[model samples]
Target chain A: MTAKIALSDVHKSFGTKAVLRGVNLQVETGQSLVVIGGSGSGKSVMLKSILGLLTPDSGSIKIDGRETVGLARRGRADIDHQVGMLFQNGALFDSLPVWKNVAFRAIQNDGMNESDARDLAVDALKRVELGPELLDLSPAALSGGMHKRVGLARAIASKPEIIFFDEPTTGLDPIMTDVINHLIRNCVQELGSTTVTITHDMTSVRAIADKTALLYKGEIIWQGTTDELEGSDDPFLNQFINGLAHGPIEVEGQKLDSAASPIEAV
Target chain B: MTFLATIGTFFLAFFEQSGRLSVFVGQTLAAMLRPPIYFRIIGQQIIRIGYFSLPVVALTSFFTGGALAIQIYYGGNQFNSEAIVSSIVALGITRELGPVLGGLMVAGRVSAAIAAEIGTMRVTEQIDALTTLSTNPHKYLVAPRVIAATICMPVLALVADIIGIFGGFVVGTQSFGFNAAIYVQRTINFLSVDDVTSGLIKAAVFGFIIAIMGCYNGYYSKGGAQGVGRATTNAVVSASILILAANYLMTALLFSA
Candidate 1:
């Protein structure tokens, strides 16, 4: 069967700084593929390109065997209609109340009226363990964890065919990170939606990913199942997964003078 | 070599910006013509851009009208002081000061406001969120603001014209010892429809400039808080300058015959 999403030889750059140079990735329907990458590793850019928020310099991005690159506005919009995104910052519309934010796509695209959308929002909020009383409050009034929950609710509220989560557990504490990770896993499993989550958090990856890809230097250098991730001895993969400063992956502006170090057991 | 490179870079950047702005304008115009016009949003924006700007425009027009009267009374020949002051005040306010000053004031307020709000939205990724929601930002954000400002500015200018003339009337009758009836009559006589219409037209154009500059700057704003601050400043500055420049062009064109 054709992959739910496929990106082939995708190249993107901003001025002289190249990001996503010839990246190749694919996610099968109902599979949770976590893209592991460090900060500024083109994770967000790649996600945006997939979401049609950013155009790649050159490449093919296909959804269920259809070419998405350079699609017309209406055509691209049709693709976007089936996709939901959870941004790293939550990116909630502060001008809107929580319920409005949660119900935005439903109201705007699905043509749901206020009362119906509100009911839908309340239901979605419940799925994320949030109370209906918080619905009337602005996003600014919510704490960071609440913001992420509401964002997740908004993302899943539409029951989109595909979902992209950008660093879903980045800023949360360990417990909240665990909570978000579990919530993401549960939600995606429940929907049976194709998902590509980009993050460097090992715990999050292990928690949610069916398969994982390592993105480094604008390319997917390695990909395998979660069990294989732990067992693999690839220098770059081991270095990153173990958070080793001394490895094939250089830190700061300088490379370590030593050879690739042994992967330390966590 | 460095100096030449610097000059080349400046010209290139300027042309690049010009091209981007032209494209933005085209998109805004096209979006304005598209379906799902969001009449409700347009209405809200009208209240925000026009109704909310009334006080500043009124106050500026009033003071400008009084100042023009005083300068005319003192600067020109004192013979027929009442007629000259009243006639000149009415002409200046309706033909020039009313629209120009009012446009500048509103530009400062509205343009800065649009830039900051939209810039924040841009940085916070709310704009991207809108796209995922399948709502065109141009239609939802840009068109309503541009439409409201363009529609409301002329009305605002008309109000300014009336208040500005009143400012002159108060000064002329109360302070300058001129008869109230005579001053009113002189102003009514001197102010032709064309004069008022020209100012109103300028106001409309200025309104478009304010909203477009704000929207464009904000829509493309990058970085974070500092970038938003810069966008706000650029919006006000560009809108104010464009209003003045457009005012001059309109004045010359309107009166050339």
Candidate 2:
């Protein structure tokens, strides 16, 4: 399968602190890939690097086989037009009504008229099961889950060919998280678009990810199909999957002293 | 070595930030004349940046003019030239202090508020949301503010000039035993078209500086609430200092001829 997005030996640093150290990854067309990592592990930085929000210190980023590193402002905007993003916090504009927020790109960039944009926005909202009456309300009035749905609706409003989700289920209840997961899967399936999701929610990974990659210390340590993940024998993967405090990944580097020491005879 | 490096870093950051500000200004100016002008938004900003700011500017100008009249009276008495009070008062307030001081006062009040509001929106990802929805933030947010301030400050300065002159008139006629008509004639006589025009021109530039500083500081703010607060404070301080410094330079240039 041809890869739709690819990163080879990407490196980025802020000051003396290196965040992404020669990271490499690929996502094929019409597939979902989820990257899992601990906090402060550069997952967000890596996503930002791909989106051209942060410049990589070295290496290549290719979108649809076109080199995107070192792109100018206009070039980056062109790239942004081809991709949709759902930020972690929903990030809806408070000054604008919900419909306006959903229709922003279409009206501003595409030059769609107000009535047409409103119609499209309402349609997009319906896809997320939101009612037409909610269109005139501000984002601040919505609950957290509703806000995320509106954000997702706005992300897909432009009919983008590729989507990036940044920690989509960070602070949601379990049922809401599953609802979001289902919506994401249904939307991507309907569009057949390529997707890259960065998340630590294992449930989200299980429901939405076709392929999973484990990121550690700015590198992809493991990647495979979800089925392969269940049967993998790697010790690090074992410790991480079971959420164990012992094993090769120690708790603050104190070894797990076995209870089978020789002094038990007495 | 460390001190020298720190100074170098400061200069580097300053230049870098100034460059970004220039780019932002250029972008806003470019979008100002484009179609789909948000007249409603501009009207709202005019109310915020110009109309709501009147009482403070007027009050400050009034006190400043009154004080200048008293000082000139006391100082001019040394040469038995206390009769020049009206001319001196009019010249001092209209030609130099009225617009510049008024601009600085508005900068402190309006610029800081704008920076804090926009900076909070930015750190919360509202700006990103705008971009994702295909809105040009420069066009939507910054342009209305720049245009509104540019138009409003001149009007505010005009009001300040009138109020300041009236303040000088009240003190001169009531306390100094000067004839009201004579004082008004001397004040009018001393004032030239150039004086009023120069002050208005300075007001427009100061307005631009204030709005630009506010938008730049707020748009680039990071971290969150603490970062937004710092940006607001920095925007006010930097804009005020720049206005005062620019006033001196403009005065030197405008009056040199």
Candidate 3:
């Protein structure tokens, strides 16, 4: 089967610091692929590259077998229409009302009528369990969890072919995090869309991801199903998943071997 | 040799900055002429950048006109003639003070606002979101603002010129004990259509500077709140400087016979 997204040997760097040295990954159609990584592990960079937010230094990024790395603005825009992104911070347009934010793609890109767009936006919000009462309110009025829900509504509003979630559950409470994870899963299943989510949250990963890729130091170190992720005896995965102090994972450029008992996580 | 190298590096940096700004201007112009020009957004900006700015521009022109009348009266008294106050004040305001002060004031108000708003959008990744949603940020955001400001400045300057001339008339007739009919006649007779047109042209250019600087600085802003702050400051400073410089250049070009 043809992959929905194919990234091969993608290398991107900022000055001397190599963010994505050579990232190779493929996400199949209708599959939810969660990429787990530590801070600055190049997971966000990879996601941005796929979204065409950042062009790769050298490599191939194809959306449904078509090259996208150097695509023109029109070509990129054509691809962008099918892609929905829930940013790490929600990134809602503060100047716009909630309904407008949700209906942004519909109104701005598709030239849908405002009243019709608002109706569609309300419907999308309902899918995310958000009420229409909050539709007129600005994003500033919403709490963080509510903001995420609204951002989710905006993402899924147009029913795009591909969806991306960046650190979706980062700042939410445990219950809220679980809620979002389940919501993401439900949204993906309902749309039957390909998804690439970036997070280090194990609970979220286990809940939403059909397949998992562990990214460490700008490379995908492991790839398998969630069950395989849990069952694997790899010490690096063990340290990351269990939040252990001692492992093969490097902290502050110092390797803490799994055999050595570190005094503290720091 | 070290000093020469330092000078060389400065020139290189200057050229680099010029090149970047040129590219930005080209992109803005191209995006401006492209399809899907959002007239709704342009109208909204006209309200924000032009209509909302009327009060400040009008008030500034009025005060400047009053002060100019007073200054010309005193300066001309030494020559045993203060009758030129209405004529000189009308000329000064229309040809110089009206558009210049209006431009400077709008630069301070509108430029800073545009920068802060767009800079915040940049730091928040809303710009990227626009791209991902298949909307070009330049078309959706920058072009509307630039076009609105460019269209509004001449109108604002025309109003400023009238208000400024009236301010001089008020001060001349009321404060300086000049005859009302003569003051009005002297002001009207002394000013030509060229004077008003020239000021309006300068106003249009100043408007372009304000909007372009604001959009350019805001578009490239990075690194969160600190970056946004820097962009806002740069927009005002650059726009103000460019307004004054462009005013001088245009003045020399227009009226140097």
Candidate 4:
């Protein structure tokens, strides 16, 4: 299968602080790839670089077989029209009502009439299981879970072929996170859209990701199917999955207390 | 030695910041007149930046004009030449104080608000969200504000000019022993279209500068809440300084002939 998105040797830095260092990844068409990483592990930066928000110091980013690294504003807009993003925070426009926020891409970018855009917005919101009454309310009025659902509705309003979800379930309750995960799965399945989700939520990875890649420090250190992650005996994967305080990965400035404990038979 | 170095570093940083501000202003001007006007957003901002600001600008000008009449009377009384009160008040209000003070007042009120709003949006990832949705933040946010301010400030200045002249007339007639009819006539006689037009033109430029500075500072804001606060402060301070400085420059240019 041809890759829907591809990145090779991506490198980026903010002043003297390096973020992404020779990172590489690929996503096949209609596949969902979840990038798991710690905070500040450059996952967001990678997604932004793909979106042309930041020009990488060096790399090749290809979307649908076309190089997208250095696209101009018009070119970037052309690509942007084909892609949708769900930001970590809902990031809805506070000045606009929920319907307007959902239909923003349709009205502003696609040039749809107001009535048509509102209708589409209501339809999209309904798809995310939001009530029609919520459409007139401002996004500031919505709960955190509801806001994410509205953000999701907006992301899919254009029926884009590609979607990027950044930390989709970071701050939600477990039940709400599950609902979002289910919604994400169903949306991708229904639309047959390729997706890249960046999250630290392992549950979300298991629920939504077709493939899982572990980003460490600035590079993808391990990548395999979700089953592989569950079954793998890799020390890094073991330490992270098991949630052990004492392991190969050290939390800075903290002593490994278990290391001082007596050796116990496993 | 370290104190001297710190002073040098501060100047260097100031120049660097000034250079960046210039670039942002240039970009704003370039993007302002481009196609695909967002009329809805511009109308919304006109209401926010101009109509909502009317009370403050009007109040400021009225009091300033009343004060000027008193001051001019006291100064002129020294030479028994209080006859020029109406002419001086008319000239001062229409030619200088109306536009400059009105612009400064609006800048303090509107520019800081715009900067804080946009800066908060920037830090919250909302601006990035706009880009991902294929909405140009410049076209969607900044251009509308700049256009609204540019169009509305002159209207505000016109109201200010009228109110200011009325204030002077009231003060002159009541406190300074000038006949109401004579004071109004003398004020009208001293004022020309060129004087009013010059003030209006300066108001327009000041409005543009204020909005542009606010939007630019907010758009590039980083870090977090502290960063947004700094952006808001910079927006108000810079817009105020630029408005005052530009007022003088435009006055010099307009009056040179």
DockQ value for model 4: 0.86
Model 1: fnat (fraction of native contacts):
0.94
Q: Kindly report the interface RMSD of candidate 3, rounded to 1 decimal.
A: 0.8
Docking class of 3: medium
Q: Largest DockQ belongs to which candidate?
A: 4
Error of 1 at A61 (Å): 0.5
Number of clashing pairs per prediction, in order: 0, 2, 0, 0
lDDT of 4 by residue, B1-257 (tens): 99999999999999998898788767667668787789988999999999999999999999999999999999999999899999998889988999999999999999999999999999988999999888778888899999999999999999999999888988999887789988988888888999999999999999998899899889989999999999999999989999988988997899996
Q: Can you write out model 4's per-residue Cα lDDT over A1-266, one digit (the tens) per residue?
A: 55899999999999898889999999999999999876777899999998889999998999988898888867767778889899988899888999999999888877899899889998998889987899899988899999999999999988999999999998999999999999999999989999999998889999999999988778998999999999999877777667776665545533355566524411
What DockQ does each prediction reach against the true complex?
A: 0.85, 0.53, 0.80, 0.86
Q: What's the residue-level lDDT of B94 in candidate 3?
A: 88
In order of appearance, the predictions have TM-scores of: 0.97, 0.89, 0.96, 0.96
Order of models, best lDDT first = 3, 1, 4, 2
DockQ of 1: 0.85
In the range B1-257, model 2's lDDT, one tens digit per residue, is: 99999999999999998898888878888878875566778899999999999999999899888898899999999999989998888888887788988999999999998899899889987776665544567878888888898999989999999999888888888888889999999988889998899999999999988988898899988988999999999999989999999898999999996
lDDT of 3 by residue, B98-163 (tens): 999999999999999999999999999999888888888889999999999999999999889999
Question: Where does candidate 1 stray beyond 4 Å?
Answer: A259-266, B78-82
**Winner on TM-score (2 vs 3):** 3
Candidate 2 docking category?
medium
What is the iRMSD of the candidate numbered 2? 1.9
- Residue pairs in candidate 1 whose N, alpha carbon or C atoms collide under 3 angstroms: none
lDDT of 3 by residue, A109-188 (tens): 77899899989989999989998999999999999999999999999999999999999999999999998998899999
Interface RMSDs of all predictions? 0.8, 1.9, 0.8, 0.8
